[model samples]
Target chain A: MNTKILRNLAFTIFTCYVTIAVSETPHWSHDEQSTWWAIQDTTQNVPLNYPFGECGIGKHQSPVDLASATIIDSKSLNKLAALYDTDTAPVFFNSGHGIQVNTSEDYSGVLMIGEESFPLIQFHFHEPSEHVVGGKSFPAELHYVHINEDGRIIVLAVAVDIGEENPVFGTILDNIPHEEGGQNASSGIQINPAELLPADLDPANLDYYTVAGSLTTPPCSEGVQWYLLPKVITISAAQLVQLKDIYTNNARAPQNLNGRSLLSTQ
Target chain B: MLIKLFLAVSLSLSVASCFAESDGNKSKSLIDPSQQKRLSTDSSQQKQAAQPNASTKSTDSQSPQNSNQENKPSMIDFCRKNPC
Candidate 1:
């Protein structure tokens, strides 16, 4: 090989090494959830780890820019409450959306209250949703998180996208009780919140995507019950802004298989 | 060796299921540390199977309203009167 060519290759290798080391420096300082500490110096807390090793790792790592993917619009989303033997009845509560069914129990979408739980506490939405499908990221992913009495969370992630304005999402966006940065935003809007759901709901249409996930908040705990709907919902960019900050990126990038099974309920 | 490999994969799967179960359990608790601590008691673990069994029926049942509210009368004790 010519000495000049060899020298050029060596320089290229050197540049790659430098780039890697620089990238790694930010990650090394992150917490177990891979989030950098909330320091005053940092302007916006973005994931230093671009692609996480696990399927879900960071707390604020939500799915973003949702206009790209194709989602199946099934009728099942409408009847989710009826399937779990639930009352699409809405119960009022202090915080969160959806309805509080029979007592304080309520969550967004239809939640099946189980035995080994803190009982399903509530369901809510994060604007622009979270979770990505295949390699395509959606605008929003609604998380139907179930909590047992133990305070453990099993979050079923449903990815939403941008499309024609649906009445269900409109209800949610319209009645949203607490605006994120607003003075009155302490709690979410409460209504017979089940109305904000897609009609003709089919859990089967929701192809389950699972992986080890962490909370989207501090102390980002791993081992979450993640269910990603194969079908994405359409949400206008404007409607999404009403839920929460689209820029916060409240979702973890997909985690590694780590030899994990991504089960589909269908 | 192939059999052993199969067994190994099976073992990993079992372990993953346990992880999923635990993760599933964690979904509700991730909101608050105090809420989680309340759930970590030995009594709650005992209720684990009972809970999913109850929830699974609700989860898979075609009638979303009829799934698990069978014990609704007792839930009043749970909601307003209890720590919920």
Candidate 2:
């Protein structure tokens, strides 16, 4: 089992958390002077590449591998829409996905952050990403990022494990383009953001770790929100390999936990 | 400072290694079983799927740098030519 440490709203992560997407992003070009000329770009955040990984000391880190956690609230968090079906066009540029998501504008059944309807902009993926749970890791991690009119981020992370059939995942997995270049040309698999949430839905299991971490990849943006779910999900062997073969090691090891706290609604 | 950095680096290596090994098993599942299904789309994985050409944007386009992925690896090239 993933390291299920006593789930603690780590003080360092509280100040952060906010913040997923496509299977195989399209090709891109980078230039130093370009508008996207960011040293720690979103695609490659090559900080201190330690032999096994990088040593994140003063960095605001996430993905703390789950060890132990508690669910204060056991009540079911009402649902909006379980079946996420839409024609929303995802804008995957540079190294992230930017789609507008809101309570009114639905995708499967992902809830909106602020009251008013906001667009679920774009979501993206990160391997061994910054957010860690109870000090553990999953084969892969997914983030469903939604933003409000004011540009505030509400990210829902879904951990991926190996399994027989991921009912909710099949929707997204079945549609992900198996080939390259092909992914962008085609639309995403028909699904919603709700099915990917934990079965509990209780505010208790909803532990978070917020850190002032940068994008795991290049042009690593700073101040961006990083919401890491305490619970990790499962997928199939074939699916994991499919993901690995396409992107290889796409995750940018953890950063320094400059002392942040992980907040939860529960 | 050096000792702390060394410890941090060592912990990072172990963590990375642990992630790799744990991932290899692929049998254990997490509490949020539906997470896989719900994560149909998000910012990061979408970057892996197809990174848009930020240079060319319509009125509604966002900043490319704010999006996802460095570049698809060589393996994906085959799929691009053949497609699924």
Candidate 3:
């Protein structure tokens, strides 16, 4: 081989190796959740430790059982306020874990919990809800994930029950991509996040069960403020079946409260 | 020299192919039989928990008209009325 050609070939090989090693991250799956923390990166022909080891040792985890919560007077606390645009063309994707809807870059929905306001990042669905209310689990749960300027996460959760068919939820179900990692972005399909809630529940005077917890998914990053609405929204049994067919049993089991205070709004 | 270049390209393609295969396999192996059983058990437990009881109210109150009333029941009311 020509000397220069051989040198370039060697460089190309080295670059490919480096790129593959750098891009390959540890994979975590719900099937083997017990071994999530031990998931290895074998791209470099070596088992590298999982980067997000918090899943194994987080003190304050999420999806805590609300049955054991202590109700506190929320008269002094500011009412829950949601300022969402009625016409948002969101991109719905199947994340393998659940059906997640991502808002557009210009989407300006804001959720106000007390005085603090967080920007709505995205929302997702989980079947057989993560939070157990009064020792009972709902048919499903909807988590609206938000983040503030300081990177604080506030997840507003709504319990889903089997009742009347929600047109908005039906629209979401109809548009959601079935395959994992598949995304459906239809500009014609508009959704109002507020409509996903019970029509009668006032956004300003919303009552919820608030607790300090962490993300339910892998990495299980702590310090997330969770506000779960006790009042549930309904979907028809057929709608529930549609949702379950997409992603059943995606919810993480409830974690220990660990001395955390579960407060309720008035 | 041409043979040497061919070998080099083949090796690179094989490396890329291996990584792609690994990625595909990771997703395919997500839900095994044990995970399916666990999912079933979780569903059964959820069904049992969802049964009606004195502590829990009927889903009828979730209606638009009922929930919009001035004296709409709050989580506090539920906690106070029940032993939760």
Candidate 4:
């Protein structure tokens, strides 16, 4: 009888352990960004702590204010070469945080910096812009996230302003799922990410300001290479309304520069 | 026998919780020690190289270039329609 009781007790303990392990994945949101380091659950009157790292202590955080006085003209910096697939259909989703577009599994696109190439993983947007330029904030910003084989990250940021309607951007807005945690896949809509660039700019020799920073979100991992394109892309005021309706002020405020220098390929 | 089983279960839970905590720490330290040292070295070199241009401020709100006109890219009227 004692042996049978022991077996049942062991099984129950194992099940409880598995449940705890799965539930421990930290839940975070932009609602209380100041408390992102230690998110609290006050719904049950008991504090369920979900702590994050680096965000509270990292020296090289991202979304910094880019000013000309602090920027360095690095002639050694190479021009950005982005080789993106022009005909692949990408999946658009609203990930509660922002409107995100995930590249198809077979879609092969690359952002070349120097000799190293980082594969395009996914891209997302931030309202009212994240990185401020010369103390001026734009209507929105787009981040094209890439990752290399060595697990390094390089995020390319483009500032968006209110102007003429961008048909390609409009296609993304039309297909975006209105509700949070919603996704639109297999829409049979093909979007060439290159079209999102400035109409006059060349993809092979793009000019940008490079800096070392971290992820704006939780865990806020540092050592990410940031490439901020100085040129701005245009979207109509109505399109801005469509984006804001889905996510308004969904951007983390600019963090301290912490003595980081912006390197530009002028 | 009940006391022994209870102790074993408690020990297991402690170890599992430790593993979970360590996983979070691991993600925070994704860049290894060698890479961290290399990054610190590169940052020092960049700071030294950028010292010359750190003091020159320009009033041009449209561009990120300083008073050095040679470094400025040819001004393209890309945002003439919607001047921010």
Candidate 5:
């Protein structure tokens, strides 16, 4: 055999293996829908897709159209109290769905619900805005997840639109890994969750819609407390496009309100 | 010269045989059982339903405690499009 021919043959075989090894495997559910395509497969899996399906039969599902609800007097609504620390380093994970930033144990940030307080756990983003307001879905949504002592979850969701570049989101998005399933840790940089919100967002003056719903993802567990802030945060077009490239069309369609009341402050 | 030609033909045939075998088994290996099981486990974990707290539940229902519990991946693993 010619030495060059032998070498070429080996190289071709090696290339084949490498290509296959690097390719991502599709993750399918029993209903034959995957997280990547499940939102769009709604027409097929009515039982398993958005609005219904899972361990719980989607009674009060999240990502609902906020515009459909009635607005109450803002003063009558209970004020949200957040004691977020200004000094702390948060670690970010890709989580395949969006960039998940985990709060460290020592962060001491907590969202107070009257007497019961839930510590800030983590926050992630969903593009094209999961919850629709005024018959329009924004470019993105940010969810700040917290948990009480009993393992109950409450999510503080903020809707985002493209306008100006968000400095905090800019810092986070700059370190995002191009490859899926990759996480990067911020070194020597401390980030306060407060920085993620608008500087003018006063908790006392803010009007938000409160609802009881299930987790947007699988397990689709119920009993999650949700508060959707009415104010829209702005992100740059480039930042939105960068995030979209990572998880194109990642937003889950708004679920049926299911006779659920969407209460908000005026 | 005939011997050399025969040697080249034989080498070409061997290379073609290797390619054929890999091609035949590629699909089967791609769906390896271990990988399937891992995916199955993830889907199975989604079966754990959250205790229903009817939509009427209010935030002030529970008394405030200085709870500082750390967050774990107790909920289903989150990814945007691809498998996490």
Candidate 6:
């Protein structure tokens, strides 16, 4: 082969290899689908297109400290009605960030705030809780992400306090997929969403702090209404260890409130 | 012959563009957001704690909400006079 032809062929092959490698390797610091560390990458934190991927820039970002909030009368506050099913099995999957419980049509429920209610889409856990109270974090936090007919989002956050074994956590923790992107049907087991709520969690008596914030994860879209249940639900310490073992640091740092009002139903 | 030349030119252009984009991406650093902000501001401050004990048990029972008026009744006032 001619020396010139050989050199050209080598150049072409090298260029092709570089292209393939770059395309195959996920962007380390931006894609939340692959790793937890990238959420910490501030430059790429706000989506290149502002507001949508911009959790850092969004005024109503979530996981705020509830300690500094205004108190209101509880009598006028509406109760939280979680209509969960016991018959249908909920799908549990590991969404790289954390273990998520995907709700089925049969297992679907609605969380009524007042006349407006959001359909319970799915729930997931963040080890060591996301939102803090008095600057104190909990063992875990469960987020029931609800979307309404208008496509608005309202998240119901439950702080999990480690204590006696919780049946709901038992079912979920038992089926946690160790590998990233792994998912499993709960082995045809039916897990009640209501069971995940503390038995003594009376919404009327539950004084929750509300905030207008974006989703904690990527594509942190704004306008998410957060209803944080101060009532602590119990899951065994062993379960907490099992959860942390999967993703040691999946939670994002709480963003600045930017003067957003944090209301409470006391 | 003309068509073949056009195809070759297009292929080379696509490959060149791909290489250019990838090169641009490679130049960007993967610094943590907090660190990146501090660096840009030229401030010498300690890194924010990762809050490792975020999952530890706490006696503080404060739990946190939003203040949208239109969404207010739908969220907090719905189950008050109405059935759950």
Which candidate has the top score in lDDT? 4
Which runs in model 4 stand beyond 4 Å of their true positions? A1-24, A40-51, B1-84
After superposing candidate 1, which stretches have Cα over 4 Å from the reference? A1-34, A37-110, A113-118, A127-129, A177-198, A203-207, A241-248, B1-84
**Cα error of candidate 1 at position A38, Å:** 8.3
**Candidate 2 lDDT over residue span A21-117, tens digit each:** 1222323232221222222323333542221122222233233332222221222221222123453543222232211112222333333322323
Clashing pairs in 4: none
- RMSD after Cα superposition, model 6: 27.3
Q: Candidate 3's residue-wise lDDT over A1-266, tens digit each? A: 69999999999999998887765445556667666666665554433345446666776777877655444432233468877776556877677678877776577888976566777767888898888755568888888877655555668888887877889888888888888768787747888798886565687677665666767876576656677775677788999999988888887787776666544443
Off by over 4 Å in 5: A1-52, A204-206, B1-84
C-alpha TM-score for every candidate: 0.43, 0.46, 0.69, 0.68, 0.63, 0.61
DockQ of 3: 0.01
Instruction: Identify the candidate with maximal DockQ.
Output: 2
Q: After superposition, how far is residue B41 of candidate 6 from its true place, in Å?
A: 40
| Residue B56 shift from truth in candidate 2, angstroms | 36
Model 3, B1-84: lDDT tens digits are 999999999999999999998654321111122322111223333333111111332221110111223322332231111111
The lDDT of each candidate is 0.39, 0.39, 0.65, 0.66, 0.60, 0.58
What DockQ does candidate 5 score?
0.01
Give the poorly placed runs of model 3, Cα more than 4 Å off. A1-25, A42-48, B1-84
Give the docking tier of candidate 2.
incorrect
Ranking, TM-score, top scorer first: 3, 4, 5, 6, 2, 1
Residue A137 alpha-carbon offset, candidate 4, angstroms: 1.1
Task: Report, in order, each candidate's fnat.
Answer: 0.01, 0.03, 0.00, 0.00, 0.01, 0.00
